[model samples]
Target: MIDEATARERVVSTADRLFYAHGVQAVGMDTVRAESGVSLKRIYALFPSKDDLVLAVLRHRTNQWNTGIAGAVADAVTPRDKVLAIFDFLAAWFREDSFRGCAFINVFGELGGGSNRVAEAVRAQKASFQCRVAELVRAAGGPGYLAPQLVLLAEGAQTTAAISQDPDTAAHARAAAETLIRCALGDSENAPTV
Candidate 1:
């Protein structure tokens, strides 16, 4: 028999896979229950409602992505390298055959601009990501312009990868990002101040 922790984990894992692969609107509670091998009652007992479950799944995904990106950026010797790490991270993720797209972006599209807890979570996560990138750019001596431009380029690369089914899109974006970083830093050889 699965323990309570195991059962909750199973439900979360199943929901993450299903929700990320299919839009949040497309996957029903029954599908999650069936896939998780947990009864509907058990799922409701754990999540309370579909909205709660959606929040849990989104939170889980957000945490996972945060950890992964942080790990990738942590070892960088300079802030410039840290900024480039974002593209490297995306390129590695795009190599996976099962890569669907950015989960938050997909969920936002599925929600269609309605104000809800899930929508708010998506917005918060995206804002946090942009802020993080901006911080790295600022540390690399970039003015205010670098952050928003880098954010736009990253978003564009993500959309292009999703639409074109081209994993190399990230590589191309990384090249462009390098040029931007050089412009921001003013000198390729100068180590960032902080």
Candidate 2:
């Protein structure tokens, strides 16, 4: 028998992949068990209900989002570049074959009406991301209002890329973000070369 941590990881990861590829409402616990190679009993032990599993997958997706954004920002030379790095990361992610748009948005759209927990989880994830952007904007000397505007650009890029199947959507968003950043900071020279 696998330990609880390993079993939980397998279930969450498998469910996350399946739910992202398909819709959350379409995938079931049995599929999670088959994909994860974990017994149904074990899955139930770890996550007593489908809602529990869905929440776990959402948390895992949040971690992935944070880690990817952090890695991209870490390579930037300036705080302003760090803000731009977010779009760079999105561009790369949009180009990936497995790209299915923002998981939080998808899940929230799918289950947000019926599942308050899912809605709250997605809301919290988005709020946390916006807060992170706000911090970056503050560090870059951007105005208080710039954070949500930048986030909207990023959010719109994800949806557009997913629907349009165009990886360059991120580049377009980046250009707009740069313009906004320049306007907010009142310095075109501060914008990155990207």
Candidate 3:
């Protein structure tokens, strides 16, 4: 007998990859079963429903995605630099061949209106990410408004980069963010005199 825990992990892992690569609405349970090699009975035994599997994948991907972005900018000399490093990190992610934009944004576009759970899960991820950005902004000695504005820039950069298939969108956003941060911090010695 396949262990239930093992089966659950396999299903969620498979679901995450497929659902992220293909929108959740597009991938069916059978495809998951075929790709995972987990029997349908075992899949149902673990998740009982497609919705459940999707939730598991969203939660898992949210954690993984947030962790990855955080990890990418963990090594900065200053808080402002750390915030700037986020753009650099995004450029790297955008360049990946497998890059498919933000999973939360993709799923929300597909099912946010019909699925409350998906909307909430995606909302939670955005809120959590904003909170992290707020912390970084605080460390950087930015004003209160800077946090939300910075998150906005980050989100806008993500979507623009994906839509344009331009990895340098992050760099453009970074320039704007630099101006905002300096404005917030009242530090413009580095700002161009032009």
Best by lDDT: 2
Residue 7, model 3: Cα distance from true site in angstroms? 2.2
* Candidate 3, run of 10 with poorest lDDT: 185-194
CA RMSD of all predictions: 2.7, 1.0, 2.2
Best by TM-score, which number? 2
Once superposed on the true structure, which residue ranges of model 3 sit more than 4 Å away at CA? 188-194
| C-alpha RMSD (angstroms) for model 3 | 2.2
Candidate 1 residue-pair clash tally: 0
Candidate 3 structure quality by residue, lDDT tens digits, 1-194: 67888888889999988987888989999999999989998899888888888889888887787787788668766778887777777878889987778888988899899999889999999999888888888887777899899889888988888888998888888898888887788765544221
Each model's C-alpha lDDT? Answer: 0.85, 0.93, 0.84
TM-score versus the correct structure, for each prediction: 0.92, 0.97, 0.92
Better of 2 and 3 by lDDT: 2
**lDDT per residue (tens digit) for residues 111-135 in model 2:** 9999999999999999999999999
Better-scoring candidate (lDDT), 1 or 3: 1
lDDT of 1 by residue, 1-194 (tens): 78889988899999999988887889999999999999998999999988788788888988988997898899677888899888888898888887888888887788737648878999899899899998998787788888888888888888889889998999888888888777767765654332
Question: Model 1's lDDT to the true fold?
Answer: 0.85
Off by over 4 Å in 1: 190-194
User: Among all windows of ten consecutive residues in candidate 1, which has the lowest summed lDDT?
Assistant: 185-194
